[model samples]
Target chain A: MKKVFVLVLISIFFLSVLSSLMGGVVNIPLKVVLEVFTGKVTGIERTIVIDVRVPRIILATLVGIALSLTGAILQSLFLNPLAEPYITGVSSGAAFGATLAFFFYLPAFPYLPLFSFLGSFLTLIMVYLMAKRNGKVNSYVLLLAGVALSAFFGALVSVLMVKSGRDLHALVFWLLGSFSGRGWSEVKLAIPLIPLLFIPMRYFRELNLFLQGEERAFELGVETEKVKKLLFFLSSLLTAIAVSVSGIIGFVGLIVPHISRLLFGPDHRRVLLASLLLGPSLMLSSDLLARVVFSPSEMPVGVVTSFFGAPFFIYLLIRRKN
Target chain B: MIKVHDVWFSYEEASVFEGLSIEIEKGEFLGVVGPNGSGKSTLLKLVSGSLKPQRGSVLLEGHEVSFLSRKEVAQRIAVVPQEYHLEFDFTVEEVVEMGRYVRGGKGEHILEELNLMPLARRSFLTLSGGEKQRVVLAQALAQEPSILLLDEPASHLDISYQLELFDLLSRLNRDGLTLICVLHDLNLALSYCKRLILLSEGSIFAAGRAEEVLTPENLGHVYGVSAELHSHFGKPFLTFFSPFEKVNEGLQIHIICGGGSGSLLIHELYHRGCRVSLGAVNTLDSDEVIGRKLSLPMAVEAPFSPISDETHKRNLELIDRAKIVILAPLPVGPGNFKNLLALEKAVYLGKEVWVVNPDFKGRDFTGRVGEIISRIKEKARFFSSEEEVLKELENWAS
Candidate 1:
């Protein structure tokens, strides 16, 4: 039964990829999209399919995978159900970093992603230091520190937004998060970091043991302190990269892992695999709606996700209570 | 196989262990027992290598435990914690398989051995406390460790489950697995563990065979309660007196009881600090067993034999020394007819005589013995229950 469910998820992911490639402002058909893939088509259709839409799709998919996988690892690491990439303060710090980039009138290409990665990485280190007590990281303290630093960075971003005159519109758009105008460069930046996901995946058994608690995991042969340090660094790196490429996309990291757990159980291997497939499916489908719903003008994909993800998460919580 | 050498450990301001040392032999079932805060659990943690001592060392097979990696330690030692709560739904098999993290193997044989195969697919969070404990045990056992450490594994279980779990542990110990268990329940410690380490105020108060280590003096000193160790089914069982009871020191009370009738009244009066002695009871009688366990001054006779002149003289001497004598609602038997005669002697001697729950409607086994009871009842004050008798005794004391 689980195999069948996984197969269905894979099929839906492929369908979402194909539909996302085809459904846009020009409304390219499936046959033309296939022809473009096979090099039978050229000109505007080819540019739209390969150069325009494909990179955005890949970038969105990579961001989705990074966020959801990081969320899965964090939830198990902290042994908390509500843990996600956003809770770690990385997204807000990245947004603050990007806001600074726009405020300084820096070029968008390498500077924005670099500045955001630096901001998120520095914020992660700050939270890590704040949460450390007597040479050990307390997860509860880590979560609280994350919340406090996130609000601090978020306030700084707001301050920058109020100060910048010409960059205000760009700052707000970036803060709201979107996949527009992103191309192969962002895709190239994120794909190399994909292998980092395997670090947490390698300790899938230890991740399962962590759900019992840190002391229990240690007793069960997991080098808990070492594993915790490695996972925290890896997840923070993944979140920082994802936020750098796509500006603070909400709920994909928080909700996709939960959705996967609701479908496949809490075993990290299955949950991780499910998140790998479902993250892209959700992101692609949401991005598709973001582009096609309003036609030439588009709603930020973050708004679409939060607008739907929040209610769906609440529904899941209510059902679980029963 | 395991030795803790003069270890010092503290959690913040409170020191849990101060230069405490003990050794556990291979194939021995050793119980670590003490009151709360006595550092029994801390000792287990130190032995399991989860908590490092500030001074000295914990050695497993002559190698320092802290020097070994977690996988190396876990490959030889498995711990069943006091309690485990899983928020996420993981099946029993999956939880058990987590034990194989250090040493890779399927836990199918362990699940079958624990009789958890039927519920192997069930979510661990949904099981009962006993079932969860069993699953946790199976998970620990799946490590295939030579030594198993359990911290109050039966604390949450009901009576039957507690027995069942201990029985299983005993069977495992018999199979050549060295077991070190931390337990607060002294009776359970006595019954299951062959050797015991009794901790008191961060030090070893006593350590040896369970019967020798779990003495009344040691228990009273450490726990501040009066404890009596009795043999139940040829195993030592401990019964404790609550320290909160009012003290009535120097008040002498003699109880004439046989069968199992006087056990509770003796415990109650003794707990109230009365100097209690027993009237003649036959050997192997339930009341005699309790009297012997409590070390109360008592007269005894052969089982099912009539009370002899010598034993009756002893019973009368006990009655003479008492300010008050209580006749428990024991059945009137031919062998103990002389006890009624002693009660008459107490009444004649102007000692305060009380008959508790004097319902002789169906208790009379000898037809002639009821007449003597009736005669004694007229001279004795009759109370329906032990509570009323104790209340009246308190009034007399004041």
Candidate 2:
């Protein structure tokens, strides 16, 4: 069953990758898209596929994988099925930092991601302190604190957007989350940070034991506090880098991991690989929907994902209740 | 092997154990039995390294448990906790495989060893309580530790499952894995553990072989109940009772019985605070055992001997002093035929006589029994069982 699901995901991933490159305002023919792969196409077609659509497709796929893997890791780390990458308030914190950078006209190329990462890292620390009682981190309290901080930071972002006069379009697009006009630079910014996932993947067995309950995991020789800390750093870093580029893409992190778990199994090793595949496919398809549904005026990819992802999540909840 | 030295442990404001010390040998199956709040579960946690004592150390294999690394400690000891509640779904195989996290495998052999092979693919949440316990036990065993700790593993199990689980543990103990189990059931502890430690007031009140430690005195004082320890097929079985209340309602009764007929009546009357006595029973008879157990005053004689002249005189005297006399159904034997004659003396004294099973005609040893029967029938009330006799006695008092 797992093998069949993997095969199907691999095929859908390739199809979504191909479809994302061919669709958009400028429709590149399938023949030219295939020819570009063979290095035979040049001129405007080459510019459209290589310079424009290719990097955008790769960025969407990368963001999807990063976010979905973050969700899977966070869910297990928190021992909560409802946990997601953005639930830690990293998305809001990063959005505020990016908006601040845009408002002050701070050098957009390098300072934007750095400020975003700093904002998320500080919020993580604050959430950590708020959730902890004495010396132990309480999972439920952490969740509540994350939500409260996210709302506070989201209000700050909105106030900054409202106060700014010139960068209104830029701020709203960043907040809505999109891969529009993204080229190799945006992909380059996220690719180097993708290896942050290696830190969490190495502790798959420890993460598996964590699902057994924290005290039981500790009894089984898992350094639970240290593992949780390291995972928080890595997952927050991954989500921060993704949001620094594409803003706050909703539900990909929340829904893709769940879909992968349902299709595969709850074992972290398998779920990690399956969600990695499924996340990109879901994101690229949503990006495709964002491109063609409005045609000339494109919808933000975040809006397109939320449009479908919210209902799918609700369906999952109702099915589970039964 | 484990040793707890001068362990002073407290939970919040209450002190559970203070200056408590114990030593356990390798390959020994030890049972910790105690009343509630006696620190039995606390002792298990201390040895498992999950709890650090406020003022002492727990040593496993000559090394302090707290000083050891997590992997090092876990490799030596495995704990089967009191409950297993996982919100996420994992198969039985997956749960058992968690034990091998430090090491690595699917833990297939451990599942097979515990007879969980057929259910390996089933969802863990779908299993029954006993099956879940077995899965947890299998997971702990997969750790391959030298020492195993269980906290009331059978407390939630039904009787058949409890026995089956203990039987499995006994087999494991025989295979030379040291076990320290906290058992709520004293009889289970007595039957399974090679040695027992009885705890009270956060200290070891008694510790030794099961038979020596589970004495009636130890149980009665620690648990605040009267009890007796009897041997059953080379094992100790405990019988418990409420403390003896001295009731002086000032009612007196005498019983005439043999062949184990009046044992229940004597025990009931003794517990109900009636001044009761028995007459002319041979020593070591089954009814005499009940009388001795309850410490009742009775006229006794040698076994296999006819009711002697002296015993008959004592029986009549007992009948003369009683307000009511009960004659339990007895076979007409030459040895005890004189017991029936005491009824005539009871009637003469104007005492109420109750004959149980009056229609049992097999006991008419005396040739002149008809005259005595008709005369006594007019004065004596007939009862079919001992319960009816006690009911009549209760009515007379009320």
Candidate 3:
């Protein structure tokens, strides 16, 4: 009951903040913005508000949902608080493909999403191969090797960035992570998997067992090794798709799930459900602020999320110590 | 029946056990005793199918244990291991419920029986050690197994919990459940076990009734202890008597025993670095416990008992095994009095032969002290302190 009420409050607050940002420098009144939203108002107000900001808002929300869900699943699968989609190297691997597509003068590959998906999939397979030991992949060792592998590919992506250097503006914006270029195609690419990943992961009890230690789970006949492999493949799929179009959004894949755990308990079901609602809403509002905070010159969506997530994360670490 | 036949175990190249064999009948309680790291836990692991022996086999209900699946073995036998670690904060009920995991039934009944239902809502980390151990037991019991293997189940628990655990096992045994428990507490083993298997260095030293297997000879040989064996309540009671602190500096310890008691006195003094000598200890005598360790050149009697007068002369040669001649609590008979008479010479030489008593007169040579003070002084040398004697000998060493 309390969780539902808190969700509604957060929705109203973020919705109001997003609308005010959508309204122009002259600061259109709430009624006028509603009028524009409802198509009663005319000219540039409707075009700028409904056509431009509304689509961007929806894209930010979708990307945020994708990233947070992936983060939640990855953390549970690895059984470590620090495991995130980026930590597994999938996001950076996708970024390397996008940069390579630009390097070859194939800016419009007509399949940036497919190329990114392939790169991320390859990276997941490689990591799984490296971490597999005694027919089981231990999460601690896997994460260490994954971080090392991710850094190696991250340096490779930086090299591609230097080689492709042209179309500096678009490449830089994509690297910084933005919803500026998102359209129905990107949204259509990510939408089908949301419920696919979301609904299954929301089951609490089985997930609780999976995240607990392996021997205890085994003694209870849980088939721990199988569960880890299944969850790892599923999370990598979710993260690869999300990063395909968003480029490399940072903190949503890292900080948001941890923040949700601090607010909710460590139950993955509640943490995930909270992320579905809170993740998008927070990102949408942050993206809006990023878009208009300095007027016409837009900041990356990653910048806005990190600007809020980083300090709060530090505060969480300090507060938890006491 | 569980049959462990001619099993050998090794780690890499170092062999732990060679040709070790024992049999446990259904509904029987077997207590296994051995020195530390004597492959006792390894034996349990082999029986539980957690580890496979390199040679030979463990036959559970006449089936090769390694051939069965782990779940299949778990269904037959439940083991409560020594050190337990489980991740996450599960309630005691939830933890105990894991035992019933094979049952595929709801865990409420197990939690209730394990006395964990009341603490069901609390996280598992809040429980104390004994509580945690009970939950582990509860989990194993939930399997409803016919055979149970416990590796030091009562080691971490307090004395009351230890008694409670044995009582529970005894009750389970009454209900026709077979239990094999490894224990360090010999008293607990004596009190509860129907048959005890004394293991020395990965081999069975003795395996049978508590009375026959737990004699002073066995204690001396297997455990390197100088012990007294007496009947208590129709059961054998073995107690350690320290040869360390002399009852008086006058009484010398010259125990005419067999098996390995020689090791005990030597260790007691060697650990204290106290000097010792030995006599009339036949090669096969239990006094070998000290003889092997200290390299004491004992005036040995021949392997067979019923000491002859010539052996008595050889035994008297050790009248100087120590300053005072001490006799351990051994079942004395007429044939061994020559060894006792040799001790009388030590007494004549002003060295005292002190006997530990529940009536030292039954061996029959008792007419020296005519006055009350002299008789009192003669009996005053009887000792019970295993520690003080060792401590004094240790001081002698330094």
Say which candidate scores most in lDDT: 1
Poorest 10 consecutive residues of model 3 chain A by lDDT?
A: A213-222
Error of 1 at B13 (Å): 4.0
Worst 10 contiguous positions by lDDT, candidate 3 chain B = B364-373
TM-score of 1: 0.89
lDDT of 3 by residue, A111-155 (tens): 565567667767767776776565445655766776786788778
TM-score of each: 0.89, 0.84, 0.68
lDDT of 2 by residue, A1-322 (tens): 7788999999999999999889988888899899998999888989989988889988888889888988888777666665665666777887778878877989866777877877877777787677667444576687688789889988998888788777677668768889887898888887766677566568778878888777789778777778888887777777878888899887788788787778867888888888778989999999988889999888888898778877876675577567
Q: Rank the candidates by TM-score, best first.
A: 1, 2, 3
lDDT of 2 by residue, B5-121 (tens): 999999886999989999999999999998999999889989988789999889988999988888898888999998766766789999999998766788899999999999999
Model 1 agreement with the true structure over B1-398: per-residue lDDT tens digits: 99899999999979898898888899999999989999988888999888999999999999999899999999999999997868899999999999999888768999999999999999998999889999999999999999999999989999999999999999999999999999988889988899999999999999999999989999999999888888878878988877845556778999999998898899888778788999789988999988888889998998889899999999999999999999998888778988888988999999999998877878877777666667776678989998898788677553
lDDT (0-100) at residue A218 of candidate 3?
50
- Model 1: CAPRI class: medium
What is the lDDT for A67 in model 3? Answer: 81
Tens-place lDDT per residue, model 3, B287-391, is 764575457656666666667777777667666556656555444455455655565566667765554442445434433322322444553355554344444
DockQ of each: 0.78, 0.56, 0.20
Model 2, first chain, TM-score of 0.91
Span of 10 residues, lowest total lDDT, candidate 1 chain A: A131-140
